[model samples]
Target chain A: MSVKNLEELNPIQIDVLREIGNIGSGNAATSLSGMLSNTIDIGVPVVKTLEYEEVVDFLGGPENVVIGLLIRLSGDIKGMMMYILQSSFANVVLNTFYGKQLDDILNVDEMDKSAISEIGNIMAGSYVNAIAGLTGLTIDISPPSFCVDMVGAILSVPAIEFAQVGDRVIFIDDNFKISNDEIKSNMILIPEMESLSLLFNKLGVEI
Target chain B: MSKVINVGIADLNVALAPDILATYALGSCVGICLFDKTKSIGGLAHIMLPLSTEAANPSENKRRYADTGIAELLALMKSKGANIQAVVAKIAGGAQMFATNSSVFNIGERNVNAVKKVLESYKIPIIAEQTGENYGRTVFFDSSTGLMQVKSASKNIIVV
Candidate 1:
């Protein structure tokens, strides 16, 4: 972990990060498509090194209710990963992931919860696997822990983590759309401050 | 005049009688509310970290940590003429949000413990609390009655 602030990343550096995201999210998207048996497409990720406070705005306001899947990345890099979907997407998730009847979004049973968590687990595994394969860094991810709560609350976990060391946070967001073009899920990867330097170093980008 | 003011993450605010101080989506963080029973003045702080040690050197925000945030909250209420000595606290939040064994950086527990220590050192008694669950909370502290109404994400509502 590098103990320095990244006020900005050069275009080349951003490009490198983008490629990393592209590879990782791309692999995850393929597996997700296979698991859901539906067409799932991911757009090019938007990478940003933002202030700790600014990151929560993308989650549709801190107070907006969201269903989130969280995991911890250990091994060579330590950080947090979250997959959040709007309630509007709950039916699709349940229909496609668990083959369960789509009813009221609020009627999520323990099985539905487990299914959502399993999806998160798979996505996390696929994401880290791709990053490791590309960067040659060892990555270990924990099982998915699920939560349904306010976006602000879910994001507070990472926000406070980065705030502890500094005010800068680096992350990538890949918007995934379902068959109908409605964005059903937002994939986020919060690489630790140290891990950013490690990745950049591997790419030969100076801090 | 019923007033409800929202305090953002790592922030603090104060209100007078018939007014309320509130904060939303507190997960793995602590909300400290101090009320002066005699003056009917209240202050609330949403602190994110346990100690200032974790704050970056030359910390620009003292209200973001428990050690500094609690003291600053008391000073703010006192500045408004609310006697710190007469202040009794009703605290909430400090939820884990997810189960993990890492007490080292288990920020929710740390924040809860830190807030308690700080308030104790200041000789303020904690009269009520709602904390340490795996759910986010929306808390409303009514200065008029020194009452805190807590609404959990899981749909549990209670007063403390």
Candidate 2:
């Protein structure tokens, strides 16, 4: 059965999407808080259909954007999640952890790798788990591998089938307020549209 | 009095007196700095990709890739009256950056391998190197002293 188009998705379906985002993001925030020993506050995650160009703009004036893509089997659905973070934002997060004022606008290599990797691990694991629960599926995430320097180059890779149908994209606006510094991270979830329908059927949601 | 030159990613600068060469911000990219202690001459090349053969335009863009870069760097040093055999090398950068399930895309690992092989072909020993993992790096070489300093996630400064 062909899934209803985005325009045809009812209010309940929209609410379902928003609630799923909230649950997934909440799990991520909780995990990060436990790891850092610092109370982390997260805004309610929002779901919307956006054009590719709009998504780029929402991410800010993209200069050196890094996108991390992971595909996992969750129950009956094959979930494809994309995590995007601006290089500047990554530096801000690092500086917050250092608790030092950045005097130079230089390279970010000065920060420790363990710290950054831990951040990626926690955030991706928690967010994926939340999505799995909402869809009533079990998912095993691949270790987070990253590409840096150019967003355009990463996105151009043919291996990542991001444009495929049955893809539901959820963009997350993550803000970390620590030591009076605000750090932002973006998370995007793109579920294969066909798999999504199968997932909804498993959830007993009336199409 | 000798000169030194320091190079950064995508950009190169020269220091003539007590010549020193350096490069920073190498991830899955290689940094090759050549030092001629006797002539007090040095040169640094910070390359991003692996081969210039894949470039849309291939006309000796040293900052774009590694293979073509090493050749260009060697020629540049030779032009400066620095003998290739007398130059000692220190290399840094080429970090994993991201953890992936497949080792095939580990550009950091690839970069280190390519650099070592090229330098070996030239019979230049890598006197010092700091690479691998998911962090960034900053490298400084003082031509006057023939000293290379590497700073990264770790606090200790690696001097070569």
Best by lDDT: 1
Worst 10 residues of 2 chain A by lDDT: A152-161
Candidate 1: segments with Cα more than 4 A from true spot: A1-3, A6-8, A101-107, B1-3, B53-58
lDDT of all predictions, in order shown? 0.79, 0.60
lDDT of candidate 2 vs native?
0.60
The DockQ scores of all candidates, in the order shown, are 0.54, 0.07
What does candidate 1's lDDT look like per residue over A27-108, in tens digits? Answer: 8788878878889877777766665457667667766778888788998878888777777666677877656775544467
Q: Measured by TM-score, how close is model 1 to the native structure?
A: 0.89
